[model samples]
Target: MRQSLQLIFTLAFSWTLVSCQTAQVKTAPEETASASTGQADPSRQAAAPEGGVPELTEDIVFNLLAGEVAAQRGALSEAYDYQLRTARLSGDATAAERATRLALHMDKSELAVEAAALWVELAPEDLTARQLLVVMLLRRNADVPVLEHLKAIVRISENKDENGFLNVMAAINRELKRESAMELMRKLVLEFPGDPRGGYALTIAALVDKDFAAAEREANTLVTDHPDWPKGYLVLSRVFLAQGDKAGARTLLADAVGRFPDDPFLLSAYARLLVDAKELEAAYEQFLRLEKVEQEQGDASYWLGLIALELGRDEVARGHFLRLLEIDGRSDVAAYYLGRIAEQRKESQQALRWYQRVEGGEHRAEAELRIVRLMVATGESREVFEWLQRMRIQYPDQVVRYYLMEVELLREHGTPEQVMALFDTAIGALPDSNELLYARGLYAATQSRVDILERDLLQVIANDPKHADALNALGYTLADQTNRHQEALDYIQRALALKPESAAILDSMGWVMFRLGRYPEALDYLRQAYEKLPDAEIAAHLGEVLWVTGERQQARQVWQEILDKTPESEHVLEVMRRLKI
Candidate 1:
């Protein structure tokens, strides 16, 4: 019986080899090129040897069969053992590579290192095997072997190409600690004194380590030594930016762009910096130059469209986005912008058509929301609600967001009762959603349903005790509507502690202080809030505190400033009516 089973297994294994021979033939050229040049092809997987079928002894056949069976049964550790044994006995690089990958998948780091070492030994000319060994050794912090393999990789590379050094740098950055990566880069730079890539990599490593002084020194040296290299100047600019010298960085990039007028990278960097500085016209010009210089114009067109929009050149923006639609992977974004341009032009049906064409990408949800708004604006409220319901089903991950949008739409176009009913239904469905509870609480506060507001806000606070907005809202409601001065102060203090820079929390603290009759403290907090956010409600609070403190003229000036901006300001009018001003 055992002999019969062995013969059956041997025949099956032979058939498997026959089936894989075609694949092996197809991959031999790539593997041969990679082995000769030490350039690793990521798509090249281990396959049957190119020479032909080897003499598979009983041990090799049995181990190969057992490993495959174990792997099929989800016994990865057993599979690794069998495969490693097969690799050792048969001296097959393919078997060794498979064992290494299996061990890695099982997260057996020590076993993976052992298998990778075997793979490198069996196929010393294979750059991928050496790279894998380097990564495994780096994970184990075996610096000596890691350095040895890294140097070997560089030596095997044709004419010691900088790509080998860059690949090693990437591995070190990903696997080693930041300090260790920096140290490794320093050693690589010293090993290859005249290699510009080594110095650039070291500068990047130092920048990532936040050793700005080291980064600046290395980047400056790189640019001075390699004056013709654009990347050195780019690194120097990054160093400047990292050190918070935006003007210096911008000036450096501007000079770089002048020197390398046809370089798309330099132009893109300078244009982005100009955008950051709000120099929209200058940025738009740079992008226009980039659009001409770049072979692939999608990125340039996208930037030109955005900068044109910011500059209020709607027709120019529209032209760029329309051009972007011709590029692959950019159609959705272009469609979204075209919709925005149509909306700006008040071409509602055209806007809807463009928005509907946005089938995917980051803008899909925003496009759907815009479509809903347009429908409501055109008095298709019933259709809008039906579409939102279908959207909730289609995008399960965004169900809560859709529910919130529905509630908002109701608040705008429907009635308060409808909004409240939708909130209740949404809460029943998403009982664990803190956002829904918080929104409903805020809405309840608006309607003066203090009991419902307290219930929902307390529920949100119970779920997430660190909900600063809920704490602030509940406290502000109590201070504004009821006489629970001490209770309101406690909650507001907690909220203020959580978000010390929140303007809303500051306003709540001021309101609570005013309820407590601490007029001077109220004036201080309200002034800080108003300075942080010059909203009409905050201005109202600041003016009232000023009026109470006998600064009536200054209070009137504050109110008048906001009223001039927002002529029908409800908060200002209500305060004036209450104070009989």
Candidate 2:
């Protein structure tokens, strides 16, 4: 609403100047001409009485001034009325345009439609005005008028650019039925085949209608005719990819890259396909090549760094990230990765500096967490506490999360009594905080405090019935530490329904099923959960489920995999003790 009002005021101000120019307000023209040569012009103050207002001559000029004043006063409807009157009385195209714009800004669609029609009538040769009328008619769903106005708009300027036509067609697609929009685009294509945009519009229309055969045919023709146009290849490749023909799309991009070797778009497309195919080395090479050609675009360099990191070439990744920081200073992404690299190399102070450099953005929270971890690892417990306290004050909105992080750290390293005291203190300060309640509940589950766990988790559920994490925690606890198998199944099922993709919830559901003696069902869910997460706890569950089902070899293999990842994982140790493997 604010933006609309701003635009209306701008239009009102500009039109007022145009109205003044037309009026040729008697402003000492001879003196003005002499003033051009730096000569002393006659003082225009003598032309009017002192303290007298300058006079408005034309009715159009008067109405324009009134409208400008009305808009400035935030009386947009009054402004529209005045401009509309001027347009009707003087047949002024600018007045009609202003009226239409203001009416639309006010969301008075009917008034906007009427004013837009007037604008087109007053300036039939104005392509922009005709386009506005077409859009207004589309809003009204006046199909016939829309078709007429759209045809006029395209007929006047279809040969100009495909982008303009594509934009109009995209707008039409949103306003009209797909079949109707496709029909209109088909007519436009037939009417202006010379314009590549018309054909592109037809391709999009066919694609929207799910007529993939027609879309491919039109796309092929478009690319064949306009080989230099990169968008054509992109659109065609997208069509191929959408049809699940990744190879076809890859081939198309590779062919395009061969033809347009220096084209960044084609190179990026080919590189991404290679990445998706797990050809990371090839993809990395291509991205490096693209970075050389498109130095200003840090996207290629960013991807190269990511791929290098994934491939464990940390030194190579560091180089690319450093180059990216030089190219795009706005990104804290490079700093975050550099911090991770430093941490991996056991450079604690260097890692801290890199993490500190991440002042803002998506990486800030993770960077702070990394800093806490580094401090804890270096045995600087007091520094970690001070850093967290500063973070709590600096990021007030995230204070609760910071408090929780501190509690989590204590739960891992401090005495159980100390962790419990901290949790109690936090809950007392923010009594209604579901996150604090859930964290305390999980801690209670670890200590076999069934009553406290149930109370906190149930309170969370009472507040938000769809709190999936709390549901999963309560259900897993009842399943693991208690004999309430049926009750556990119910809670875990609810959590699973809320977040079907959550591996944690899936593991809970499988564990509860295993407790209920539904071994086959438990095996299915556990296998799926392990595939998604591969966490130590999930591996424990998967291995136990396999062992129970008489797959002793597979259970050992799963345990070995977990041990290979985390040799001393508590979950793996517990599994070994329980399963006697």
Candidate 3:
């Protein structure tokens, strides 16, 4: 009789827990709904007052209560074990779902898979159960089962308003391997041949997998079969772009926009492609059309503003950016561009106000730097230095950057001694900073302090052995300021090997070669460097070598071109003076 009474009490307790859990599930949010006793269907709840309470045998009662008690006490492992056992023994959908959620919470993926499979078996009509199972199977790379459940989901969703194929494709695109996702979509297309979404999914998957030929083939078929679908043309254009045929992409998108004149996606693609191809005028016209078609004008306005700036239409650019200032999340970016336009218009105070309005985003740092520059331009150098100090304190992570900016400002407006003192203070603060050391070394080279330059550059190279810039700078300095021609050659050779295509290193090699009296080799390297980077310094080097090699006509032409472009080029002028030309 005592044992019987205990059993009755346990049963009553189980029924109470089920009722409370059902109530919570009905009211809880989706993310927290899984924390309830089980995922009970509304129909099942209506059919039974206890919400489809499973048969409460002694074992079921003990395990269910144990799991609930363990979970409440923050003993998730114990709860998961009891819940999984209860699910297996009772074969209850609710128990299985609870076990699955518990295992997932514990990050026991394999155990979650086991419970999820059971839940799906017991509740084949439950979409949530199927989705959970699909995720678990995908995590395990069980492609065959994943495909089966995905097909089931599609069939189930056909009766509903949602497109299950697209939903599954999105999920798998993030979770599954690219090739595996592409193959699965291919099979799904074969399974649902009449569904255009399947073909589109396959094309996107193939594109993501970088199988351009397959993507092109599928995209072509989609466009041919569904000429009314604008996405087909968009995907085909992307395939051409993936294959580096930007001209083909531009041509196809042009035709697509002609066909679908008011399609926002197609029009936007065509406009952006034209911008990339540097056809700014045509892109501006397309973006104007896009602005009309698009309900939200943020993207179109942003691109229009940039294109106007590129086309030297500051007034037009300002109008677009001003319009964008009214939109959400665009105020900071719009303010930054407005600041740039103000600077271009020589409205220093207006530019300062606009830049100050840029509170955050990718442009905040640049905006601040511009503000400092404007301050110096306005003869507020003292105030600018004070502001930089405050900024350094406020943004500790950007201390090095602030110091570098200060160094540049001092170099332009203050004396060379001030710049050197600032570098000393920055190096004291960040004793191990390689960037600071390298910058100071470059500045030292400019000051003709060879000892300081060598010490600082050697420190940087010691910190980062593969610092090609430091190696090249050291090499060029030694060759120019001292009689270390062979040592300079060795250092420059190492730097060249590290960055074979670096124009700066190539120029260093050419200069060191000239210092060693290898005029022909110097000419070759200098020519290559000048071709790579048409800087005045490099042109000066190339011209000097050409003149020494008796190519006076070519040397004069090179010097004339650079002088016409940069009349204040000291390097070219100094070379001409030294050569008595």
lDDT of 1 by residue, 456-540 (tens): 9899999999999999999999999999889999889999999999999999999899889999999899989999999999999
Q: Which candidate number has the best TM-score?
A: 1
TM-score of every model?
0.81, 0.79, 0.77
Q: Write the per-residue lDDT of candidate 2 for residues 333-422, one digit (tens) a residue.
A: 999999999999999999999999998899898998888888899899888988888988998888788998888778767898988898
Q: Give candidates' CA RMSD values in order.
A: 8.0, 9.1, 7.9
True-vs-predicted CA distance for residue 366, candidate 3, Å: 2.1
Error (Å) of candidate 3 at residue 4 is: 28
Q: State residue 108's C-alpha deviation in candidate 1, in Å.
A: 7.1
Colliding pairs, model 1 = none
Superposition TM-score, candidate 3 onto the true structure? 0.77
Look at candidate 3 and give me any clashing residue pairs.
none
Give the lowest summed-lDDT range of ten residues in model 3: 40-49
